[model samples]
Target: MANSTLLSRTRAERAAAERTTGEPVGQGRRIGSHLVLVLLAIYFVVPLWWLAVASTKTNAGLFGGAPLWFGSDFALGDNIATLFSYQGGIYWIWFRNSFVYAIAGGVGATVLSVLAGYGLAKYRFRGRGAFFALLLGSVMVPMTALVIPTFVLLSGMGLLNTMWAVILPSLLSPVGVYLVRVYAQDAVPEEVLDAGRVDGAGEIRLFFQVVLPLLRPAIVTVLLLTTVATWNNFFLPLAVLRDPNLLPVTVGVYNWQALSNAGAGGEQVWNLIVTGSFISVVPLVAAFLSLQKYWQGGLSLGSVR
Candidate 1:
């Protein structure tokens, strides 16, 4: 009886210890995951922080001062002034061009993706499987590989050096279509459409009233993706556009960098470049922040359902 009582006391002590300490393996894993996430966050944030700091510095401060920290002199306002005034304010033109391309391409791609994805998800159509297969295969193909072919095709069509060249290519987003397709399949129900149809609603009416609202999250996601893609597109714009007037900010910034690299004759516009880059990122950040709620809400709704 004394031995049995001792064994029970030992077991109780062990349980108390376990309760106090929790699971060591799970706790370690959580710590490790948090550490990794913190590192990643720093890695991504450092460059942006550097860019912001660099934008606030003069040419001399940018090079001579600390690379990641702020300079003694604040030149952000001056840099922005020079960015606008330099070379007849061409940066404004580039900025405007980027806006045009991003909006046109993003909206167009989102519309097409929504329509195609919704159709693929809801409708029974001929060659649907084959088309979807082609889409999946296209998604696997790297975008860079298509640049040359796109360039050639645009050249043949005499569309090179035009905004259309950039905007047109940005419109066909295979990933956007695929994302929308996957989202719509579950988010938009067949029964909902059928219920609307039974009420004598036209297809267009049904799409507008019943289906489109359900796919808001997917639409916003595609819009942001396509817009950002078009905004940040460097290679295609570089290859297709030769005119300085037509260049988007991405290519235009590179042009400034190339000039800076030129041995002695070319002007050094590093301050302007840094400032312009900072300005260019603002719109995209604002867009994401503004639209974040819709997608987050959708995700929460899905999770709850």
Candidate 2:
């Protein structure tokens, strides 16, 4: 009886200790995961932080001071003024061109992706498997390899050095098409389509009224992806465009960087380059922040379904 009592007391004490301390293995794993996430966050954020600090400094301060921290002389406003006034305000032109290309290309790509993806997911057509395979293969091919061929094709068509040169190529997004196809397959049920058909809805009517609303998340994702891709495209624009006015902010910044790199005779416009780069990132950041909720909702909806 005394031995039994002692065993019960020992078991109770162990349970109490566990309740107080929690499971060590699971707790350690959680801590390790949090540490990894914190490290990754710092890795991504440090560059942006450095860029912001650098943008606030003058050309001399950029070389003299700590790269990650702000300098004594805050020249962000002067830098902005110079950026706008430099070479007859060419930066604004580049900014405008970027907006045009991103919007037009993004919308066009999203539309095509939605249409193509929806068709591939829902319809039973001849050569569908072959078309999808080609798309997957295209996705695997490096975009840089195609830049030369695209340049030649654009040159032959007399589209080189024009906005269409960039925008046209940006519209052909194989990844976006694949993303939309996968999303549509699971998101839009055949039962729903049949129900719409039972209501005498035509294909176009069903697409607009029934199918589109369900694919909102995929559309937003594709739009953001294509827009960012076109905005950041440097090699394509550099290869095709020679005119300063036709260049996007990305290429415009590169031109400034090249001039800054040239020894002695070339102008040192490092301040403008850093400041311009910082400014250029704002629109994309805004776009992601604004559209985040839509995609998040889509994820939740998919999970629930």
- TM-score, every prediction: 0.84, 0.84
Error at 275, model 1, angstroms = 1.2
User: Which pairs, if any, clash in model 1?
Assistant: none
lDDT of each: 0.85, 0.86
lDDT of 2 by residue, 85-169 (tens): 9998899899999999999999999999999999999999999999999998998899999999999999999999898999999
Best by lDDT: 2
- Candidate no. 2 TM-score: 0.84
Error of 1 at 288 (Å): 2.6
Report, for all candidates in order, the number of backbone clashes: 0, 0
Each candidate: RMSD to true structure?
11.0, 11.1
